[model samples]
Target: MSRRPHQIAILGTGYVGLGTAALLAHLGHHVTGIDVDVCKIEQLQRAEIPIYEPGLEKLLLSNTSQLTWTTDFSAVQQADTIFICVGTPPSADGTPDLQFLQTAVASLAPYLGRKQQIIVNKSTVPIGTGDLVVRLLEDLAPEFDASVHYVVSNPEFLREGSALEDSLYPDRIVLGGLDTALDHMISVYAPLIEQSFTPPASAPRPERYTRPAVVRTTLQSAEMIKYAANAFLALKVSFANEIAGLCEHVGADIEEVTTGIGLDSRIGHRFLQAGLGWGGSCFGKDTQGLISAGREHAYAMPILQAAIDVNARQRQMVINKLLRHLRTMKGKRIGVLGMAFKPNTDDLRDAPAYTLIQRLAELGAVVTAHDPVAMARAEREWSHLKYSSAVNAAQVFQRADAVIIATEWDEYRQLDWEALVATMRRPLIIDSRNLLRHPLTAQVEQVGRELKGTIGAAL
Candidate 1:
């Protein structure tokens, strides 16, 4: 059943928020994007994407008239559905800080009228956070009492580069809140619910994936679902890396091993890419958040905990591999290719490159890093680190000991192999991602030096 267009406000114009906002507008809803950064808002107002997301800028432009950008929280007062897409980053103690969510709710407290509005939690938050946000808002706003303020946990599973596409045609749409408002949500997303909505022109047309049924459950279950999904993915990735390590010891090809196991249909083969362990905004934080939550319930999640531990050790494995090849990291000028977690964006919040960079630099190595997009953020994060354009970055490897492939980007794979060997003092390379192939490997070995990779051994 097609319904009247709704007013939707997305808080935080970061990758998740902007992508959500643009996709909603494309779905024929009136979207007002609010952000604290005036510069970002201004850029969005002109149909410019503040961050790098594939095909996002064009979508923003197409939906410009329907999408309004602002830095005001008062816009929430008029919103029929308010999606809290702010960041809930984990602190050092492995707990998610609710500062951003608290601030967003408090700022919009005064303007929330008696009229009922659906408050949606669209960020990746700790389990039971939906209830906490509701309690906080109710406690903060006394005067503006509403009979119905349904707090729904609608956690986003958006990958950075493909966020917009994921938003429009999601694998699932889990809504957790009062069953009373289930009708409203179904009505609100009826277009997608019916599969009658058109995707943003800029994005790739989604293959007709089975339309996900809206699972209505208690808010707690929905919150748990998000953490579970991410934790399981992290676990799978770590498991694959562990297998990759074993493959190295036993002279087995991880790629073939994964392929054979993946074809079983029981494993399904996603997130099984044996490379540097998983790192990004989601896996590390979500795992830690789950572990913290487990402690509150007097349960020990050893399996999950070990998964996190193994991921951390994977970084050390890379470092150890580099150490084995060169024997010493000191005085070596290392070129780190790809700094962002998964590439196509500049988000370095929990990027594995952070750990790799600091550890290498601490070992008395001068690091020269290059990312197709994230070098600027890397520079800001690591002030002492140096940046290089793609063309000249290989120069850092000149007279340098080892080059570590940290992030796998398309451009990084197509480097001039001969030139790289020619420029480097020692043409040694550590392929952390196993991104290089036979031709490149043979070339590197031709120069009386061998390139070592993680899939197994000193090939």
Candidate 2:
């Protein structure tokens, strides 16, 4: 590890920006997190985290001396490396809207110093976005020497729940840039690339990991890597759900089938669990961006398109299962088990639970939801639905006719099923996530298959 720390500025305080800021600070770099949201900046200035990510707050607090939070863009002038971590949300046509990226670049143009600096894109963006950024910067700062400024695409692959660990012990660090920008980007992540930094106390180094490999490639290929990786994972999940649907029709247990197929060396099990389809800030948008990018090039990405279709169908499958069990959802109280996309984070962007709740509401099913961490955000976002505290899961069960396990939180798996069954009016457990064992009820329906015959029959 280099004894001299690089001055780093991270744009945007969302998951990727804040996590990267904290992790870099923890790695002994002087980091300044810049965001346009005044409230978010204020919150971070007060040592408060606006988002829920495990170990993030502690990491921020522990490295407060090395980290700075502000809405000031001037910080970029002093930084040796600037990371653009702003959101590239999907537009109406499913293309990544680079408005934020463009705005960030334009704002930083005037402050770009004559000294050589690397501007890295840490956001998941379209393949040609790096070229776009370079052009935009050139147009914005024609007076500034172009040779001193370099644009690089270093897309992030951080998962929300375990973002800190993922950033610290990543599978790989991908840098897409010309040779001129490569050395600065590599130096910025040298600690992580070489595994020389001490792991944060909150998230220790994992036993099954080694130093992450660094893959240096052209800007376009590196951009495609981010999209392709996410699209492939989404495909795996949708494929699993498709198989689960077949398992139900043929009376085959999805668990057994997945287990058997997962044992195959080539088809190792990771995203093979059939459940409510993927939702978060990344998968859906990145997949959509990839599809839209292909369309622009007159190329067809049928596999990626089908993956999106299958994911949407999986949510509908859950709805169909509910309708089959209740005959009609009209006036029935359905207790939704989780609201967030997945466990350990409060992010509800594109969560499958939102789709299910909307459909259930249209069917006149009164929805009551619960999540260990996302209930407050859910309440703020979807005020029409009812929410129960985590401690009041039994209360929700008692009031509802059926319980739907939407998000597979670890706490949901450890729920007192017997107590919940006793409380439910109908004792119907719709395990969309397939996270539960055989409940003590005859009316247990899951995504893969349903146990309709007996209470303790094959699950």
For candidate 1, write residues 391-429 as lDDT tens digits: 355655676667777887877767776566567767777
Residue-by-residue lDDT tens digits, candidate 2, 220-272: 99999999999989988989989988888899988788899999999988889
- Which clashing pairs does model 1 show? 399-425
lDDT of each: 0.78, 0.85
CA error at residue 427 for candidate 2, angstroms? 1.2
Taking all chains together, each candidate's TM-score versus the true structure is: 0.93, 0.95
**Pairs of colliding residues, candidate 2:** none
Give the range of the ten consecutive residues with the poorest summed lDDT in model 1: 441-450
